[model samples]
Target: MSAAAPTSGPATGLLAVGAYAPPNVVTNAHYAARLDTSDEWIVSRTGIRERRHAAAGETSSALGAHAVRDLLTRHPDALEGVSAVICATSSPDAMFPSTAALIAGEVGLRGAAAFDVSVACSGFLYALAVGHSLIAAGLAGRVLVVGTEVMSGTVDQEDRNTAILFGDGAGAAVLGPVPAGYGFQSFVLGADSSGGPHLYLRGSALRLPAGTEMGPYLTQNGREVFKFAVRTLGDSAEQAMREAGMSTAQIDWLVPHQANRRIIDAACERFGLPLERAVVNLDRYGNTSAASIPLALDEAVKAGRFKDGDQLLLAGFGGGLSWGAAALRWWGGAG
Candidate 1:
């Protein structure tokens, strides 16, 4: 199935991109020193050697704000007409007052329409779709979509299952008008709530009984998640590509969520795309949840990898058993 033709509306696209990882680095050896795992075991499983950790008192908002600041620093006029700030984060600083609002305030966008999306690792793509729609509907001209995570705060340091696979980072993209036919072409989003039990963070929010006990940490059934992610990611990519009226051969880059090396390889193989056509950085940053795609995109852009008019496929899946994908024609220039 091919995607519907581009709709007639305000042409919207990513204008710029930026990312930030805290200075603190945690190597596999850091975990090996405490856990029963070694560097070879961690790398062979997750393809991660080192990951960043947020410093003391650092929050998702702070990490996201840093990314926005970086974007603004390079593209000083990025916020000239930005009227909305949407942050996708599962590790929010607090339950109230959205992390987007905090980031907007920090970036001097005090009165912008700001909010948060809690779709886990698929969040950035979700926020990107929302930002794209906002522009298409003329609700906002320029919107900042950020995916920030302090996963280090959520993972149990003692739980090797999760602790070894997550890192803290933030990535932001400024969405605005681009030349016609040069932005987002189509999007696909889906979820299977039954898979929710495979990954979750059980906390006191559910209001347990007086004596009920809960583990206040991110937990997961790795085998279940691996199975679900591999299938959903490939399907989501095909759906998004079809919706964009393109075939796998037309895709110039595949930017999947940086969850695991095996999952990424499987998805690429399913698409019949070579590994070289995919943007991957999980080896250095592990899984930064929603930040993965944009972080990799930013790195690729700065490295002069994407050319103008490149067809890019962005896909992700995460904790809510949610997955999303988008097809876009890149115009380059984003850093």
Candidate 2:
């Protein structure tokens, strides 16, 4: 079914993007030395050769702030009339004083409304939709959407299943009103709590099932998650495209969640999109949860891969068993 055309209102556009990754690089050899794995094995399985690790005392806010700072430096006008900051993160600095608040304070946006969205890797897209709606609703003229994750602290180093699959990074984008028919067109979002058991990080305050115990580290059933992701990626993207009145031939790029290479390849094949037209960076950053999409987006934008008026389809799935997709045109006629 096609998405209903949105009511006339301010059209939200992605003005600029930026990202940051810690300097400390953790290669496969580091894991191989401890776990029974090798560079070839890790690459073959996850397509990751190395990933960034936050240094001692670094926090998600710090990384996010850095990314925002980078964006501001490149496009100083991006924050003009900005009134809110929405941060998407699964690994937040604290339960209270949301990471968005911390990042806002770091970037000198003290009076802006600040909050956090915790939906694992799909969070950036969720937060983006919220930012877009806020602009359309006239509540905010512009919003800063940041996705940051410090997964190094969340993963159990001893667990080969997850340790080798995550990294730490942040990406930020400024969303503001663009010309008519020039920005975000439609979004498709969904969730299934039943898949929660397949991927989760137990929190101290969360109630557990009868025999379940709280665990601090991130946990996952890789096989189950892999199965869910491949299907959801293609399904979500297709749904978003349909809603946006776009077809596979009209899409210029597919910026998917940087989870697994195999999942991405399978999803592309199923969606009938060529692998070459997809933006992928998992080989270097691994899976940065909420940070993956924005990080890939920022990199691609900087590389001049996405031209004005390019039709882009973004899709992601993660821990909440949540999946989301957005169909948007690259920076177009409007400012």
TM-score attained by model 1: 0.95
lDDT of 1 by residue, 1-335 (tens): 21223434776888998899999999999999999899999999888999999999999999999998888777889888999999999999887699999999999999999999998999998899889888888899999999999999899999888899999999999999998778898888777777777788765477533442477988788999999889889888988887777788788899999999999999889888899999999999999998999899888987889999999999999987899889988986554
Tens-place lDDT digits, model 2, residues 52-72: 999989999999999999888
The deviation in Å at residue 294 for candidate 1 is 1.3
Candidates in order, TM-scores: namely: 0.95, 0.96
Q: What lDDT score is found at residue 212 in candidate 2? A: 39
Steric collisions counted per model: 3, 0
The deviation in Å at residue 174 for candidate 2 is 0.5
Candidate 2's TM-score reads 0.96
Clashing pairs in 1: 3-242, 3-243, 3-245
Per-candidate Cα lDDT values, in order, are: 0.88, 0.88
